[model samples]
Target: NLRVHLLEVEESVDRVFSDDSTKKAVNLLYMYPNGVNTVSSDIQGLTESSTNLGVVTTLENSIEYDSTARSS
Candidate 1:
């Protein structure tokens, strides 16, 4: 299960990653969290900024951003 998701098959691994790279995949045992603090702080800042801007403006901005960033 995890092996397939991790691309344990040789051809699958080769197709996904460069042959010269040292690491092609990591097992659950090696997976670790490192960026939670930075992301949490950014989210808190967005919440505070949105509160100052009011909900209507924030929602309109979000809708405009989504429309601009997406294409048919």
Candidate 2:
């Protein structure tokens, strides 16, 4: 189940980053102070929607998934 969740996160990240609607390149670093790293992405452009920040929203959702998985 954990593996499946992780795969889902991977796919979500890939899909969001690969989207062509994004305009400015950005990097997302998912790291822990304890030196544990889960996921990171250095990709080109974020979505152009000013009111709807797609990257941030997606990352937040990803973090929620991570938290839920951790608790389980």
Candidate 3:
């Protein structure tokens, strides 16, 4: 039950960030697809500062990850 709730919250955060008018928040928690967790935001102004550049994979799953960056 707790995991499901957290997943919903993660989705909500994704939606909020996708909005163009939304201001950057101080924190973000992503529940990776395989179950691992991550914290991130584009506030640092990296060259690739967007959700596409900030995803982390869940180590327990075998799904293919497209990003070339190493998964944390």
Best candidate, lDDT: 3
Clashes in model 1: which pairs? none
Q: Write the per-residue lDDT of candidate 3 for residues 1-72, one digit (tens) a residue.
A: 123233334333322233432222212223323332343464343333222323434343222233333333
Task: Give, for candidate 2, the lowest lDDT window spanning 10 residues.
Answer: 63-72
Steric clash pairs (candidate 2): 22-46, 24-45, 25-45
Candidate 1 C-alpha lDDT tens digits along 39-68 = 235445432211111111223112111111
Ranked by TM-score from best down, the candidates are 1, 3, 2
Identify the leading candidate in terms of TM-score: 1
**Clash number for model 3?**
0
TM agreement with the true structure for every prediction: 0.16, 0.13, 0.15
In angstroms, the error of model 1 at 36 is 12
Instruction: Evaluate model 2: give its lDDT.
Output: 0.28
Worst 10 residues of 3 by lDDT: 20-29
lDDT of each: 0.26, 0.28, 0.31
Angstrom error at residue 36, model 3: 19
**What value does the lDDT take at residue 19 in candidate 1?**
44
